[model samples]
Target: MVMFAIIPYLALSAALDPLAPIIAGQLHMSAQTMSLGSGLGNAAYALGTVLAVQLGLHLPQRRMLLAYAALLVVGSVLTAVAQNAAMFIAGHTVQGLATSMLLIAAVPPLAIGYPRERLHTTVMIMNMGIFGAVALGPFIGGLQADADAWRPLFWIVTAVAVLALLLVVLTFEDAPPANPDAPRDLPAIALAAAGSLAAFLGASELTSHSFLDVEVIAPLLGGLALIAGLIVYQYRAAQPLLMVREMLTSAIPVAGVVTALFAAAASVSATALTASVLSETYGPVRVGLLFLPELGGAVIAAGVFGLVIARRSLHYLPLVGMILLAAGILVFRLGMPDSQPLALLGSALTGLALGATVAPALFVAGFSLPSASLPRVFAVVELLRAVAAFMIAPIFAHFAATVTGDLNEGTNIALWIGLGLALAGAALGVTIYALSGARPQTPDLDTFLAGQRPAWYSPPLLSRLRRSHDLDDLDVALPVPESVD
Candidate 1:
């Protein structure tokens, strides 16, 4: 069931990424138009987190999963039969939205409901579900691109969606909502969707129009402003939709969110840029072959995560992952467009970094909160992650294509930006570890959830910052620990 629910997103992404050019040519669309479709689809995926959470609060879990699966089938069919760019975008958007909704609705129960001894298995499942699928994307995309057709891939996805729907029906089990009477946060959903749409639309326009053009500037700025408002509103609402206050108050959770966002943005953008440059130069099959090492890297990282997940060293995992991610970006910045071996090495390293960091950070966030809050935490984190990671790809693609007259030079420039984001993310992870006073040794889940302040937490630098911002007031009491077994 889990495999069926999650693999479709990976299949679609992998198929679309390498085949973007083919799809564009077949539909008589520009690369920018294709990017717009991809960007909007991803944005819908990100924003759908809110909808998933809302529905989870009010709807029966199994029924919602089934509904989401049905929507996935419809979306995949629409994409398969799409005759124009608009139809394609609409279909892809629905696929993206439905996939995320299913993810948020289904995954948390597995994470929280399972026994503590089984957590390693849960983490492995997450790594495979997210990164494993991503690792396979290029291979699948390359094969289809080599075949010069996309409808077959879409048809396969339609079948997968159907399988997922059937799995939901066969495995049906009734589960009550976490809070059946929780009021819906309509404003949060509206802002999230609108902000994501506008931002992605603006970024997509950058392909055909200059960054200064109103089409690019207005939506970009307006969307950012709306998102800012959503944050403030979430912070103040007594029953916030996304638990913004809880995230902000905790050092570990803040770091996890930042790591997820920045790492995703950097890695996804780099992949898009490199794939674009390489596919044009060497063809899609060869380019896809180049990225096969990522699967190995993701597998190795997942193994490492399984080993350290229950130990205190888990705190340091994200930091190490971020460092690796930065190194990967550097590899691309230094050797892209001219060095295939270096690019392959970079791909493997980035894949390892992703497998190492994002999921571990998610685990950190989940453990930081009580079990009851797990769904909300996952929803909020995934929302921000989608916005940061997926939204940036099209913008990076636009820049790589047009930042300069030379495509290689343009890609190089974008790689530099990605490198900066990677380094920044690494530094943020370090800050989080330092601020939280997480030890190199692994602490028990209870110690972590207690929000223990580090010895250095009261040092002059932090004390002054805490005083200035009155951060102490935001501290939340740890819930009574629940027995894991």
Candidate 2:
């Protein structure tokens, strides 16, 4: 059910790049219009994370899940049959909104609600469902473009959405609000909506305008500022919607988050910019074929993650992923846009790198916090990730296209920057572990599942470097441990 629910949207997100031209032409839409639709849809996705968390706190979660799935069906149907730009945009926007809502509603319970023995399987399935779909996207996109048709793929997507809705019906169970007494954070929701809209709006304009143009720069900067403001607002709120303060002040969670953000930002550019260059020399189908190994790599990574989820080795997974990511960038750089073998190998490695990094880092972060707080923790991590990955991809693509007169040269430059980010994220992660005196410990799932404490012990950030005399000042920075009744 989760697989069907998530795969269609994610795969299509990847495929959309290839299909955009055809769809735009057939619908009498301009490039700018298509870009705006995509951008707004992504903004809705980003905003939906916060809204989902808030709604879950005070509403009947299962009922809301049903509603979200139904809306997804409506969105998919509208998109599959759209004749005008407005219909397409509206449908896509709704799809994004509903997908994120379902994500928050579904994923965490599967993470925490299950028994200890099933944790690995649950995580592996989740990993494969999400990243595997993403890895498979380019190939699907390429196939659709090669056929010179977009509606067929969308119709297929609509079928999958329908399947997801039916599964929701079959799996329905009664569940009450998560915490009826939790305060409604309307300000946080507003900030998320505004920030996401502004940032994505600015980024989408890159399809036509310069980065510094008023149409692009003003909203982009304003959105960024708002995002920053959101972090601050959440950190200080009396009852925060997400676990910003808890994760930030802890060493492991901080390290995990940094790796996740940079890994996500770097990984998207790996495929997009390189694929753009590849498109110059190869047809859509051939380029897609070259990238097919990406999906295989993602599956392998999912298996490996399953093996290590409950072990001390999970702590090292993100670090190892970063190394693989850098090596993948090197592969793409050596061959640039021309070597078919290099494209095959580089895409696989990058697929592995991405599969290994983001989800594991999220779990690492989740394990550091109380089990009960996992959902809220996830909401914040995903919110940041959506911003970093989605926003950075367009910016990086634009930079690669415009930074140099030669497209190949510009792509090489972007690949190097990606390599740097991967290495830097790894370095920062290691430094945090060393400075905070964090050690890899097997997660205590028994206590963690009881919601009494974290799966592993995480030190306060920089606490090891502080003198014993100053310990009192940092005590307030520590999370008050939760206890299960």
Candidate 3:
């Protein structure tokens, strides 16, 4: 069921770049519009995530998963057959919602069902779908986009989605235990979904233009208000949809947010900027082909990091990725005037960097907090990353529009912007690693989830992973033992 749930995103993420140019051509719109569509899809995905968290509390898990998977099949068809931009967006939205719900619902059961010691590794492997999609999606989807019209690409997506849905129905058998302590609230879920959608739209719009405009201001402000209300309601309501306390204080949540920002920034910047420039420079077929090395790199890196590297040591992996990304992007930007080969090399390096870093970050984020909090915290972080992807892409586009005299010039500006983000994100990762003290490794999840503490405590799981990877011990800054009683 879990694997099936992530299949659409895997296919979509890779295909997104290739698909954008076709959509733009058909719609007779600017690349910015295509960028907006990407943002919209991500925003819808985030909305689905938030809703899934609440759905788990109130609804039957087996039924919800089944419904979600069915939606995926339908949404895929809608996307494939869409004649206009509106239909495309609608299809993307439905897929986004279904994808999120399916993915989120799969987690809690795993947490409760699996042994604590193996949870981190288990989740990490499962999350490879995100990376797997990124690595393989572009190549497979790109081929279709290259050979046939873009419309056919949707058919492919539909087929994959249908297959996934069927697999889910066959595989997903366990049902969640009824939680008498947790009550469901319909109103709260609705408010959160609406607020998230508004916020994503508003945030995304801000990238292209000023937030001061009426169109931008209204959605942004309204979304903020609704989200604010959500928080207040959660705090006061009998049964809250979000696990606010755990989300804020947990090491995992903090790390996840930071990780998502950097990971998303790296991959999103690469794909969006590359798509925009390459569509004009190389044409769609070549542009899709350009991502081949990237896919290979991401797959190899993710496999090694997930399978071979210990979880704790993986924190620094993203940092390493950022550095490679910066280097690749810098090379691509500076060398663009020189040759296509240079740009290709740069793309390869960037793909390799993303491959190495993104999966590990997600693994850490997904497994860090308690099982109960996974969906909500992951949703929030994913949402923030969506905000970044939407907000950053248009900024790059607008910069290209104003500063550049030509497509190449605009690409240069976008590349530089991407490099800057990579550097900044890398630096933040270093700071986080330094602050997290070294602790001995434990095989049990109880240690990580242990809210109770002795008078004196030590650093948690991060340090253990770091040491296992032979990284230097981070200095202890906070008290080791947190007092629970």
> Cα lDDT of all candidates, in order?
0.79, 0.91, 0.64
- Residue 388 in candidate 2, Cα distance off native in Å: 0.7
Give candidate 1's TM-score. Answer: 0.89
> Tens digit of lDDT per residue, candidate 3, span 106-221?
75565446655565466455645556666566666567667756776677778778887787778767676345357676777777667767766765565456647775678877
- TM-score between candidate 3 and the true structure: 0.78
Ranking by TM-score, best first? 2, 1, 3
Ranking by lDDT: 2, 1, 3
Where does model 2 exceed 4 Å of error?
468-485
> How many collisions between residues are there in candidate 2?
0
Candidate 1 C-alpha error for residue 247, in Å: 0.7
lDDT of 1 at 342: 90
Which candidate comes out best when scored by TM-score? 2
Candidate 3, residue 229: Cα displacement in angstroms equals 7.1
Pairs of residues clashing in candidate 2: none
* Best of the candidates, lDDT: 2
